[model samples]
Target: MIVPTRSSFSALSCLMGRLFSVYAGYEQQDAHEFLLNFMDKLHEDLNRAPHRKGPPVPLPALVDEAASLNVRINHFWCQHVDRHLSVISDLFEGLLVSSLTCLVCRKSSSSFEVFSCLSLPIPANKGSVCYLQDCLKLFLETESMSGEAAWHCPSCRQKRKAEKRMIIARLPKILVIQFNRFRCETAWQSKKLQTYVQFPISGFDINCFVDREQVETQPRPAYRLYAFLNHYGTLATGHYIAYCRAGHGGQWYMYDDASVTEVTLSESDKRNAYILFYTSVDMRHQFSSHP
Candidate 1:
């Protein structure tokens, strides 16, 4: 297997620090934050269409109610890819559809947003143990906008009570989920929630959270956990470690700052899971039952 030498790893780290000044020194950083920044920079550096220099012209709104959901999604995706097409997006990017309905007008509008990672909030009501599905449910629950938070309705011509719902419109080959473990109670105070979140090790189905209207005709996507990062300590000080499978359905290994060890994950270690990485399962049998 090809692996980076110690010198090569150090050189790459230095190069990253040079490119992103915030990572210049040996200061502790958030792994998710670093991952996002690194990916963004790498995407820009490796963008397939480097000649496109100006801001892309926005595509006109889809006004034809007769259009199918899948057609609309494809249109929006094509517009998005026209400007930002890259291998990174092909693998990690997915689209989120946000639907908002004004209570006064009863008119609804939907918008498409792209995401590379999902930062899911851990429900405060959850006790010591929580399930990943529970967090996803909370994230997808319809929210009401009222009072000062009301949305301005174009049809109603005023700020009004609205209902908002978001769902996955596209599924990426690689899915990255981050738990919002670090919370800020105040401007100067924050705490880390150490809730034990149990996630599936294999055959995780995300279709439950997808927009059923759009995917009813498409194949269901399944994911399998291949790696996860864990955090130890409080918000101010912490150490990060990773547990990864060696290969497809392989043994798990723990990677610390400098040491790597093969070990089975215990319940205690599982409690620290902060971020998870899942790859799409592409077996033909995985889709046979969906239709």
Candidate 2:
């Protein structure tokens, strides 16, 4: 869901109400049912008169609504409200296997973590980072943890320097990539990285980001861009907009506040992209076939 900066509660309510209206037409039973329940509660709450006029709802609060809805859906499903309501977890959840290697003994340890999004840091260079692959490569690159923060190796039984890296143990149907652009070194000062990152509209293969052993055995998943959230301006104050395609290989449109207009593939569209949304091509085909 997209809303303008400094938007009123009424504006947010209207946006969500319209979204639910569109979801009402979807044929997916599990998703439709879950959204219907959420929409009903939301409508009831929004319809109630406020005691007094207060500050406008922040963007982060609206973002948290998704998390709130997910929790509610999980509770309802686990309570046997629906046996087939695993769509949210199935589409967004994925596992990451993080490995740390001791530089001295070469002893390695690994752990699994669950994530719904992948946050990547833009590479620092004298020149601009030109491609999304460069950022992805930097994310998978090994870094040494030494000095005061050295890793304590159990095998070596001492504080030793270690190399750490993370690999995708499992891939999700919907992959959300967040660009780490905001940096805060001190309590008072914060900065936004304006590095231009080039990303592909389609055929983005993330096989290199996966564990080498897994990549050797399994087929690499091909992803196609579906939507992206962009932030314009600075870290302290910025406007959020989104560009999304209607269907697989469909035309793209820019969503700014309540206004939406068709946009062509161009460099201008990539300028402020903060979060990229990609879907597995295989999964898209499966969904289209089933639908």
Give the range where candidate 2 is weakest over 10 consecutive residues by summed lDDT: 76-85
- C-alpha TM-scores of all predictions: 0.89, 0.68
Query: Candidate 2 on 79-179: residue-level lDDT in tens?
Result: 32122223444565566667688899987766556666778888778256558898878888888889987889989999999988877756777787888
Which lDDT values do the candidates have, in the order given? Answer: 0.83, 0.67
Best lDDT goes to which candidate?
1
lDDT of 1 at 117: 95
Q: Write the per-residue lDDT of candidate 1 for residues 14-115, one digit (tens) a residue.
A: 988999888899888889999999889878876775344566667777788646667777888777786786667767898888888898879877788899
What pairs collide in candidate 2? none
Question: Could you give me the TM-score of model 2 versus the true structure?
Answer: 0.68
Q: 124, model 1: CA deviation in Å? A: 0.9
